[model samples]
Target chain A: MKITILYFARIKEVVNYSSEDVVLPEEVETIIALKSWLSGRGATWQKLFDGSGVVRAAINHELVDDMATFDEGDEVAFFPPVTGG
Target chain B: MYLKVSVQPGDFDVGAELQQLRAATPQAGALVNFVGLVRDVSTDGQVSEMVIEHYPGMTEKALQQIAQQAMQRWPLLGIRLIHRVGSLTAQAQIVLVAATSLHRQAAFEACAFMMDYLKTEAPFWKKEVGDFGQHWVEARASDEQAKQQWKLPK
Candidate 1:
């Protein structure tokens, strides 16, 4: 399955990218699995999903928990905790 | 109930916005608005400029949901929420939330409710550029505490 991932604010700065489209493996079924897969890519990616940052996730524009599942073509975003007024 | 929610990079004219709402909803006896501004200083002194970023699609949706929640909770005739994103200078307006109702209490409470929700629910981040350097504004635990008060009783 292919999905679009979005990064925002400090996460974008740290990742050095804003958005990307990637094909998910069968093992990457849940958001937690997806994070684990991304973390396996390297150190920088690991730091993002690792317990280090206050990362939050949303699927299809609605905020969700780590265990949330996404379907093919879904848009998933990873961002720092909101600070807007 | 009437609701207007906007998330844009451009500035909004609060007076014009409020005037238009009032013109359209004459039955409303009370009007309340809250405007958030970029401050000149943070914990680190003397801020230069601030950059506000948001998830383009989700920002509007979150504001709409918050405005709808306010309408559901109060007898509001109308509600308008505008949040600005992108580069902003110190003292520039960042957001405006306005509510109208037949009575003062409803309007006041709804406006406050919407703002409190927006602080935590809205998908926006702020980076303050100061003499020390730029840093993303940290989310306040107090903001979460404020929004928690509105959670439906379990």
Candidate 2:
């Protein structure tokens, strides 16, 4: 399945890229599954998804927890929890 | 309920907003105003400007949800939530939440409560401009703790 991923706040700065479109394997069930799939790709992806990483997720523009599900044509965002008032 | 999320500039008359709300209804006995300023000191003392980024649609929706929550919680006569995005200087008013209610308690509590939620719940991103370079500040555990009070938040 193909989905567009958005990066924001600190995660955007660390990744050095704001957004991208990627194809994931069918085994990618939930957001946690997607994280594991991405990590195996390389060090850059792996380093960003470590257990201690502070990444928040959203599916299709709605704020969601890590367990959010996804499918083809989904718009998933990975961002740091907002600290601004 | 009124909401304004802009990237243009942070020059608005909050005082006038307060007065207008107060004069609009006789039931309003209290008006509460809060101004969130951009500071040079981050947790790491990152001294400089801040570049704020936001999801145009989602940001508005989240603020609107908060405003609706405020209305549901109290008898607010007027509510204004103004947030300025983009690059901002030190001490600039990044956010303003003005709420008016018939009772002083509800006005102050709801205004303060909305800010507490905004600090963690809003879809805002801030990049610190520093002596070395600009970078996004890390999300902190303290912010999470502060949001715990609103644990039952929808």
Candidate 3:
């Protein structure tokens, strides 16, 4: 399946890309699985997807947990915890 | 009920906003507003500049959800929430949350609740430029705690 992934804030700085379109393997279904598949890219990906950071995810403009499922054209965004008011 | 939520880079006029909000509903006998500003001092040093960024579509959605929650909890006639993004200087207005009600207590509580939820639930981030250099502002545990206090009674 194909999806558009977006990175924001510090995550975007670390990933060095704001957004990208990627084709996921069949095994990758949920956001957690997608993160695991992307984590295999390299060291930076490992650091982010390691679950150590306070990263949050949103599927198609609404906040969702890692268990959230996505379709082929879904938009997924990853970023650090909010600090705004 | 009237609810306005916007995420923009430009500054806002609080006086005008208040006047408009009050005029929108004559039955509203109480109006309360809270404006958040960028402070100059930071933990490391003085913050010379600040930058705010947000997920555009998601930001408005989050704010609307917050206002909706406030409306459900309080007897509010209207809500006005505006948060600014992009580069900002010290003492600049960062956010505004206002609530109108038939009485003072509901307006006050709803306004505070709106702000507390905005700090934690909204998908906006801040970067501070200080003597220690630029750094993304970390989410404060206190903020999460404050938002949690608004849980509806069972």
| Preferred candidate (lDDT higher): 2 or 3 | 3
| lDDT tens digits by residue: candidate 2, B1-154 | 4333333345567788667666765577788889878887866666678888887667887787787887887778778887888888877778888888878888898888788777777788878887757777666777777667755657
lDDT of model 3, residue A23: 92
Docking class of 1: high
Q: Write down the worst ten-residue block by lDDT for model 2 chain B.
A: B1-10
* Worst-scoring 10-residue span by lDDT in model 1 chain A: A46-55
Model 2 C-alpha lDDT versus the unseen true structure: 0.78
lDDT of 3 by residue, B48-75 (tens): 8899989989999999999999999999
| Residue-by-residue lDDT tens digits, candidate 1, A1-85 | 9999999999999989999999999879788999999998999999888897788999999999999999999999999999998
Question: Candidate 1 local accuracy as lDDT?
Answer: 0.91
Q: Which stretches of model 1 miss by more than 4 angstroms?
A: none
What fraction of the true Cα-Cα contacts (under 8 Å, chains A to B) does candidate 3 also have?
A: 0.84
Per-candidate iRMSD: 0.5, 1.5, 0.7
Model 3 lDDT per residue over A1-85, tens place: 9999999999999999999999988889898998888889998998998978877999999889999999989999999999998
Model 3 vs truth, CA RMSD: 0.9
**Model 2 regions more than 4 Å off:** B1-10, B23-26, B43-46, B152-154
What is the iRMSD of the candidate numbered 3? 0.7
TM-score of each: 0.97, 0.87, 0.98
Model 2 TM-score (B-chain only): 0.85
TM-score of 1: 0.97
